[model samples]
Target: MPHQQTIERKTARTTTKFTGEVTCKGGSSRGIVKDLSAAGICFQLYFDINATTGQEVSIKSDEFGHLTGVVQWYRGDKIGIRLNVSSNTSAQISSYYKYFR
Candidate 1:
């Protein structure tokens, strides 16, 4: 199948260590964000065997702020999250855009 539309403005994801949470069918889990973009994010978890693929999740970061997302993929202690919004996100995103540039 063909890929969907792009949402992120940056190709290179900036490294970020921020607290976040994931809500799945099993429940919520506290994790750390590895990096982030307007479209998606990567998590570095303490446990490797909690979440599953295709699970709907919501994540909130101190730096990136709150976002409703879904688990696109997962492997080991790392999971990929696709953000829900296409445009008009929080001020934190704009802050990231300015600081990173």
Candidate 2:
């Protein structure tokens, strides 16, 4: 069997660990942002919550401020989000991670 690439990521991702807030459907939870990219982000919530693909979510952190995105996938306590911002905004957010790197 050959390894398959199930998801094709448009932008490169960088490892990061930061505490942030994730808001969805009137509920909010604390999550640890694990990895970030210009196009998407992956974070692990402190607790399990109801979240599904296409659900709208808002993420805020001291590093990236506020970002609006849609849930792309969720597994266990981890969730992935695809940002709704433009490339310019993505670039700005990516720049913030440089200091952490």
Write model 1 residue lDDT over 10-101, tens digit each, in one string: 44576788777777776677788888776778987765546777777777666656677778888887899877765546456777667653
Q: List the residue pairs that clash in candidate 1.
A: none
lDDT of 1 at 97: 67
Candidate 2: worst 10 consecutive residues by lDDT? 92-101
List the pairs of residues colliding in candidate 2. none
Candidate 2 error regions (>4 Å): none
Task: Tell me the lDDT of candidate 1.
Answer: 0.73
Mark the regions of model 1 whose C-alpha exceeds 4 Å error after superposition. Answer: 1-10, 88-91, 96-101
Clashes of each: 0, 0
